[model samples]
Target: MNKKTFLGIAALLAVMVILSAYGHKLERGSDNVISLHKLHTLAQKGEQLTWSDFENYPFEDIGSGLYIRKYEVEGGSHLLLSGGNINLAPMSINLVKTSGERIDIRYEEIRG
Candidate 1:
């Protein structure tokens, strides 16, 4: 009832909400930002997605059959997706992870 007691309860609720959001990072995730590592495993397993899957989330062209959304995760990165044609409607997906400096290279060059 007092100011101190009310503040304590509010603080506790805030922490719980943050923790709950973090726990669901593997799903569609909170604020549209999913864990990059979790998505990597799916990509490795040949999982794919379409723009419709995101309910038409806004994305900017990143070139090379790729596009990226505004949502950011840890290390200041955004979710990236492939801009493939009809045959590849289920586009390949990835989320950028910026550790430090970036290496400018083609996907195949680095992947190969």
Candidate 2:
């Protein structure tokens, strides 16, 4: 085949690979970034998290009565988490960049 034909095939393959990778990322998403509305509903249903509800402990703390206290979610430039006295673990949040700003929060919970 000619050089031009080879280059065309190579470019098409590259585009296909890029699109496939992006599709996977869209499906997997981040670590534990749930919708704020869903989180609010969970809290309303008596689920305690690190961001909003501080009165309740939803997860155990090192096998103790308390399970989860604080959590953090990291993306690209956005940092969403509870920065207070309560802490389950130490993490850095990095917010991703897009056409518009998309905020996603992460948290850690103790499960037995």
Candidate 3:
């Protein structure tokens, strides 16, 4: 190829490389399972869920023995809490999508 053509090709490659790097950051998630953007979205929506954006980490289930979900978010984990009661048997939570970009979370747990 001509010298000019080679230079153009090199510049294009550089631009592609930069775009790829930025794109990777957008898709990056904790343990490569979640997307950083998604985490941010969840946070903005006040969703309490363990967020491991920078590093790939797993959400730890803090057993029912302790009502510790509140502590998780404070410790850098995204804890998404919803409408649920602790003093109940077989406590569980269900997330409902009310509309676009909206979610309703219900929390239920068994309490002695």
The window of 10 residues in a row where model 1 has the poorest summed lDDT is 103-112
What are the lDDT scores of the predictions, listed in order? 0.48, 0.39, 0.39
lDDT of 1: 0.48
Candidate 2, residue 66: how far the Cα is off, in Å: 30
Q: Over 4 Å off in model 2, which ranges?
A: 29-112
User: What residue runs in model 3 are displaced by over 4 Å at the alpha carbon?
Assistant: 29-112
How many angstroms is residue 29 displaced in model 3 relative to the true structure, after the best TM-score fit?
A: 6.3
lDDT (10s digit) by residue, model 2, range 2-77: 9999999999999999999777667755534443444444434322334334222122133133232332222323
Instruction: Give the alpha carbon lDDT tens digit for every residue of 1-112 in model 1.
Output: 9999999999999999998876665454344544445434434434344455544233456565444433344446655555546345534455444644332122211121
Scored against the true structure, residue 15 in model 2 reaches a CA lDDT of: 100
Scored against the true structure, residue 38 in model 2 reaches a CA lDDT of: 43
Which numbered prediction scores highest in lDDT against the true structure?
A: 1
Task: Sort by lDDT, best first.
Answer: 1, 2, 3
Q: For each candidate, what TM-score against the reference?
A: 0.35, 0.31, 0.29
